[model samples]
Target: MAPSFYETLVERNKQYAETHNPAPTIAEQMALGRVFETTLVITCVDFRLNPDQFLQTKPEDQFLISRNPAGRVGPALQEIMLFDVFLGLKRVIVIHHTDCGGSQFKDADIREAHKSRLPDHSEIDHMVFGAFDEVEQSVRDDLHLLKTSPYVPKRISDQSLGFVYDIKTGLLTPVE
Candidate 1:
């Protein structure tokens, strides 16, 4: 008789919990959640990368978070901006990291791959990858899109800032 997948996972989790030790002073430190009116962070969907870790932000600092491939603000993200901005959110932080998986494919390549995988849908030849392999350009482009998007509030663009994250050095450098 073999143990089920869930059983194995549970056993591993229990073992890890038992072996893990917390930092002696970390628990005693007072953690006051950050306060902000409007702060949205848009970044890539890579599991290994976390936007907050790079930005050195507290958990409650950002009001909204939207993640996609290359962290490019597409149609869906435009809609998110409408809600966040109209509701009085103050800032939009565009983050694009180095060494992203989306950087592996070009616009044409991605379109062809999607067309092949999604045969039932219309061939996606018109879907252009606005920001290709350029991380800095991508972040800047996203900020531009958010600022210029018709769905977004006109004032939202005033406070938006773009940043590029270096995976190797863990640095968040401003784009513009």
Candidate 2:
């Protein structure tokens, strides 16, 4: 019989816990200590990729936000950043992984795929290149957006950081 998804998850969690040392109780959280430094990690929406696994940071230590293609931080992401900045978050990490779906299809193809479902008057603009086109360039653009956006605290100009991850080797290299 096949294992249930929940069971598999529990097993994985148990394995992780055993490997990382179990702190099953909330009292252990106090022992773990609080993470006050604010760091934002942006990555793709791919279910296979987890920013936390790469970060290897404790839970609640940093904000991990994933976007499609990892390009152009969307409105929701901006809101999170705004909240973090308000709360005094100073570091930002933008991660774009290899072989992104957003980089797989051209804008016209994407638009065409949704044209029938979307309203005729919808002002949807698609990207020209897919994930493979220019991931490095995309990371650069997103970094600039976070750095220059009026919503972000100006003090973060020199402090925020960006990184790119290679899914193949599971390696993370700095973008800036």
Candidate 3:
């Protein structure tokens, strides 16, 4: 029989620990010297939208990535608050991408699709899927969210930036 997904993950992790840094390196190590030096990346769950590739960071870059369905700041607020208090966050980068799945669907669709899987259909109503119609605008919106959020400190908010990553051309365009 084929290995279960969990088993496969464990096996792959074992290999990673042996071959990789097995701990934070590069950017993470550098941030240790200064408080609020760590850069927090809020990116999409899409594998093709890997922030490391577009940001010129390596696996060992050890940057913190808070990935959700659409990389929207609303959903990542909790993590951001916690990270700031603990890891001392410096920069908040919001990255949305071209041809993103988040743009393909609406929150209503997500609610309907997930309704069947839940014990109570109305339970799905409370969830936000973070869908957006336009990619660039989404990034800008998230950046604005971070900038205005009272929870996000001025140190982190002032440094917040947004970008739209192009999957086809492998480029990232800043969204002002």
Candidate 4:
């Protein structure tokens, strides 16, 4: 009787498109194949921690965002490699947040759950869920992983940084 879930999304997107205007300058740059200096931001898939809000910049600007299970750069290394090689990626910022759902469970727990729930699906056993315990340590580890990865350029790796976002306060603290 009513619109489906995807139909609702289409309607919402139509409404958003009506009010949100595309930046002509950014559009022109993209059209011209111009490579702009941009920072690659790796953050958790958590909806509470927004890269745009924390960085105070629009997506159209010089920011390439990658959201993953725990904000671990290792999982998204292919994308990072491509961006670094072609997208003028000069910096990398890894942001792991406090009170993350990924930190709530261990890898073993997730593996056991998957095994129990999907006994016939043995392929899931090899999957790395990226569940973590220490948020700050995870951030640092990710930063190190990015810095040491051969796929990431030395210039970008040298500038790589780590941060912990406080979901409750909407504040980011640098993780050294």
TM per candidate: 0.70, 0.69, 0.81, 0.85
Name the 10 consecutive residues with the lowest summed lDDT in model 2: 123-132
Expressed as tens digits, the lDDT of each residue in 22-126 for candidate 3 is 555548666875343578899899978767767887544447888998889998998889988887677888888888899999998878878868757676788
Instruction: Give a tens-digit lDDT track for model 4, residues 94-165.
Output: 889999898787887888898999999988878888988799989888888887888877888899888898
Candidate 3 least-lDDT 10 residues: 28-37
lDDT for residue 57 in candidate 3, whole number 0-100 = 77
Each candidate: how many clashes? 1, 2, 0, 0
lDDT of each: 0.72, 0.65, 0.83, 0.85
Candidate 1 contains a number of clashing pairs equal to 1
TM-score of 3: 0.81
Ranking by lDDT: 4, 3, 1, 2
Alpha-carbon RMSD, candidate 1: 6.3
Model 2, range 67-155, lDDT digits (tens) per residue?
Answer: 65544454335654665655457666677876666666776776666776775736655433333467777778777877667777666
Task: Please estimate how well model 4 matches the true structure, expressed as its whole-model Cα lDDT.
Answer: 0.85
lDDT of 1 by residue, 68-131 (tens): 7777777446546565645447877788888887678788877888988997767487786644
For model 4, the superposed segments whose C-alpha errors exceed 4 Å read 1-3, 24-27, 30-34, 117-123
